[model samples]
Target: MTQSIFDKFQYYANLREDVARLDTNPFNVVVEQVLSETEAIVNGRRTILAGTNNYLGLTFDPRCIAAGRKALEEEGTGTTGSRMANGTYAGHLALERELADFFGLPSSIVFSTGYIANLGILSTIPGPSDVVLLDADSHASIYDGCRLGSAEVIRFRHNDPGDLDKRLKRLGTKAESALIVVEGIYSMIGDQAPLQEIVEVKRRHGAYLLVDEAHSLGVLGEHGRGLVEQAGVQEDVDFIVGTFSKSLGAIGGFCVSKWKELENVRYAMRPYIFTASSSPSIIASTRVALHILREQGAELRKRLWDNAHRLYLGLRELDFKLGPESSPVVAITLGESKEQALEIWHDLLDKGVYVNLVMPPASPGAGCLLRCSLSSAHSAVQIDAIIDAFRSLRNNILES
Candidate 1:
């Protein structure tokens, strides 16, 4: 055989073998049909959707769908170019203005996706002389952003504001040049950052602070502005990055900042300069969803929380491991062994419940997670059904 460049695929093949020869590939759960925001068809079975991040459940809202249809009929399809090219349409600008107004920030820039927003900002802002102090459990997009930038990256203990403070102190003179980045609500374990303490620490170090509210937006604060507002530290945060995919029920991302200079990021960031802009339908749907997210968000948030509490308490009562006090994302930790975790995931699927099965590289800790993200559209009966399904699999999970 000729020396092959495809030799690297062997590692993936062996890793597949590690998961008990892949009789049930959790990664291959194909959605045959989407019934609603909280239900889908998989494997010819109508499965309860407990894994999606549709917190506000606006995906199938009549108004949002109407707006999307209007845009599709009127604008055809994509913008077909980058923001720097022929892509900055009027709707894009309008959405940016609306987002800045909602957050009460001075400036905002929309990106092709939530991931791109992080990549563009991180790669462009910090250079060789700068530093990024991040949480150990920061999202992959955040980590990839650091890799793209010229900054010196440092991670402290997860959820430890004290450790972050110590790391900043060790930076000494470089502390002033450091950018402290954290998420409002960590997606992996559904835990929150001690933002108040972290903000105080950054203020003491004379460093900048950026908060990614991807999971917290439309799920926290009185009006759902996110955890930065919930903690009453909006003034202390220099920048915020969030997604339209989660709560807004559309696909796009944005970065709003108190500093108006963020507008200049477009000129320097390659991701924004090179990628195609979001379509008219996406932008149109997102704008209407944003409005609904503002007006009806309180009621939706109430429903979401109620469902989350029910599922969390139900699982806990069943003597299963759970994430630290739930909000919307309820992560049930499985065993340290990958085989056991896979078994639990497959069992739940067989019971007509669909949840996110997270393992190494994606999960926060060494253990795997059966992460359930509740939605506002999940009815009380649906919640009961999900709980019952999990209860039915208790024997398998506990025994495994």
Candidate 2:
């Protein structure tokens, strides 16, 4: 019998069935209402939101809402066209310029979403003659971008600059032109990259580097420019890619660089050219959020880190196996038992705490992960509630 193309997903279909049998689905969590940045209504219960990556908690900022409302009234609801066509609204151009200025870069290109920003730049920048060296634990979009491009793709050990150096050395002469890709803060475990060391290795090998600051943008650096600024390697790095969704609390992505050539890449990028640009309201709100971040980001960053440290220490006190360090993204390592992971995840939800339940392939190691992303807007009480929820699951986690 001829095999159906859908046969490939049979295993996932079985997994879904098993989850349904448990009477809970962590994957399709629906928020009935967002009461605040840190609280939401889920499954008809008031739950503390610990998964949404609203790092700076600007999602409901009055200024951002006002900006969006004004744009919605003046510019209509949608752009309805790609930027290369008719979607380059005045707000879009202004946002791009502001982003470029924020990064102190010569050029910038905005994308409809963070995923496509990676796709557009990664797929277009590396030619057939070049090589793409990336971290083994890179986000799916990063891997997909490399796959879409014509360049040969290679993986180095995660967060190991020494491994990257050795790999680049093996390339010999080609190392000079190879494109190295890594993230400022890894999304899964929330550990930061050793960017200063990575920069040294890149310089020694004469290679270019791209740091995806998706999670780290508002969480690091005195100026909140991300790991690049924190590491003080701005001059050494070639490209900086980031998303506005997390810190800026809007839906968009951007790539900024000192190189003037990125302007030319914009025209050649199919994802950027073909996809409809962000709506006027999103752009307007994003611009206002960016402005807010610039003006009042330090306080927000302090609050975010304080909350992260609090939760991290609280979980640690309970003897929970967590990610390596204190970060806004705190992941509890659960042994290889999807059932136990699901049970604990369901329990957390029952206790009015909602986090991300990560299964294998998506998770880094040979285990499941209960990932919690904290935000600046999360108050002390909310952070403690998140901790208490996990503390209540001690027996389940200990068993695993």
Candidate 3:
């Protein structure tokens, strides 16, 4: 008798039981559960969304909606082929040009997704000979890119410039050819990378820096360029990668650079070359979204930050442990236990508030988190309601 390949996935299947016990299913959001106009009728109750990553609240925006509808009517739903084949549309070229102009860069390359954008650029450029130094807590896409590249993947402590310097010192002369990767704002903890210090270290080591601004784009910097510009280090970075998913409220990713040769990568990058390009509708909506983001981002940012600060203060007053204390994404830390976190999550859900319940491996320090994402669309009244819910839940837990 021989074991089958199917046996390997049994571990993952079994892990669902553990997740079930915690009432925390990272991959199990119900259909229309977090939508603006839909109901998550669990036992006949509706819930307000606090977990969704729709940061700018543009998913339901009339402008984006109208543009998408117009494009779909004019260009159909999909391109039906890879960009290397018949997939390239006029919309694609226009979007790329628009993105390049937005960044004030000479060239830009667009990918089917922000994940694929990172995957395409990082994997295609670095070879086995080149070393890829990444933050310990980089997104799975960044890690996957390095794995695909066959580059020596070296990780430093998250956002620790000194640890990065030490790692570069270990690499010695090889550091010059190394590609250092860091996120502008980490998705989980929502803390920003120390760009100035890291850039100074990279300059000393002569390393090329790639900043993934997936969560920072349309959220940071003047005109929402990203944290690189926010930190006043745009000229120091070699590549800037971002996604249109979050703040831009569209699907697709892009890499922008002043380097003329970046355009040549389109020929060799598998993720970009093999994958089908974005649809006309996505491209058009993103272009409009980018325009709006550039002109109106500061006002949105102000609203979002005010919401974040209020929520942060509210949670703190309730004595809930928070990660990073100040960030757009506020995560209520659940310490080292899962049971308590699950109880709080279930209680909050029952109270009509939906939030992300993150557990180990996905969370830093093997922790559990009730992650809340804020948006400009969230009203002060809604914020107060969220706070009141937490307060009530805290009291109930203490009494229990």
Candidate 4:
């Protein structure tokens, strides 16, 4: 008997059954269906959304829509080619320039997606002789990028600068050729990296630093430049990477640096060279979104924080184990039992509220999480409704 390639997928095929027993299934998003906004028909009931990461709420912005429409009309649908080929249009160049200006960096390179941005930059910048030190809680993209580089990949304790320093010291002279990567805010735990301490450690070790501002760009810093600016270590960071999918409310990614040599990587990077360039509409809308993010991010950030505080305080008061205690992203810890988490998740959905159910590897300590991502556009009433759903679930669980 021969093993089949389909056998590998058998585990996932039974994931629903496993998830049902635990009561926590992170991959399913089938509750509510809607075009936009929080209100959605979920399981045939109108539900309010809390799972989405539309942080800035620019996805439905009229200006973004208009810009995208204009580009679609002028440039057709797709670029249909790689950037190094015939895909580099005037709009692409303009967007890159705009992004460079937005970050106050001399050079910027845009990628088709945020994942590609990390992959391109990390894989191209480092080689076999180099080392990539990353936060254990870093995103999958960062890990994938390091793997693509064929470099010595090392992980430190999540958000632990001391651990990072110990690892760097262990490397000894090789630390000089290392690249330390950290996220502005870890996605799952909703906790921030101790960037100042990490930067200090990197500086002492004489290693380059790459800060992926995927979640923090347009949600942190003075003009939403990111955590590098938030930590006041803009000059210390060698490369700053960000995504448009979060606060920018678009779909793309970019890497910005003062180094002119970064431009050369455009040729060498397979991720950058082989991937189809971003569409004209995406570039146009992203450029406009970037402008809006830079200008109005402060005000929007205030509202997002306000909503986050309300939800966090509400959940904490309701006796839910919360992560970090402070951050725009709030996770309601539902203990280690996946079953309890899934029950609560289903109950929340049934009560007309939707939130992300995280479990296992995605959640820290093999814990389960009801992740709530806040946006400035969410009204206080909407947040209150979400809290009410959690409260209902808690009451039901206690009674049962």
Q: Which of the numbered candidates is closest to the native, going by highest lDDT?
A: 2
Q: lDDT per residue, candidate 3, 257-371, as tens digits?
A: 9788898888899888887789889988998888788778889888878988998999888887786657778887776666676677788877877778877888877777788
TM-score ranking from best candidate downward: 2, 1, 4, 3
Candidate 2 structure quality by residue, lDDT tens digits, 245-294: 99999988999998999999999999899899999999999999999989
Q: Provide the lDDT at 254 for model 4.
A: 91
Against the unseen true structure, what C-alpha lDDT does each candidate score? 0.90, 0.94, 0.84, 0.85
> 32 in model 4: Cα distance from truth in Å?
6.6
Ordered from best to worst lDDT, the candidate numbers read 2, 1, 4, 3
Candidate 2 residue 294 Cα shift, in angstroms, is: 0.5
Clashes (N, CA, C under 3 Å) per candidate: 0, 0, 0, 4
Off by over 4 Å in 2: none
For model 1, how big is the CA root-mean-square deviation?
1.5
Q: In lDDT terms, how accurate is model 1?
A: 0.90
TM-score of 3: 0.94
Clashing pairs in 4: 22-338, 22-339, 23-339, 23-342
Kindly list the per-residue Cα lDDT of model 1 for residues 1-400, writing each as its tens digit: 7878978799767667866565557877788899999898877788999988999999999999999899989987988998898999999999999999999999999998999999999988988999999999999999999999899999989979899989999989999989999998899888898999998898899999999999999999999999999999999999999999999988889999999898877789998898999999999999999999889999999999998898889888998878778779998887777777877787777778999999887998787888999899999898899889888888866665
Better of 1 and 2 by TM-score: 2
Residue 185 local lDDT, model 4: 81
What TM-score goes with each of the models? 0.97, 0.99, 0.94, 0.94
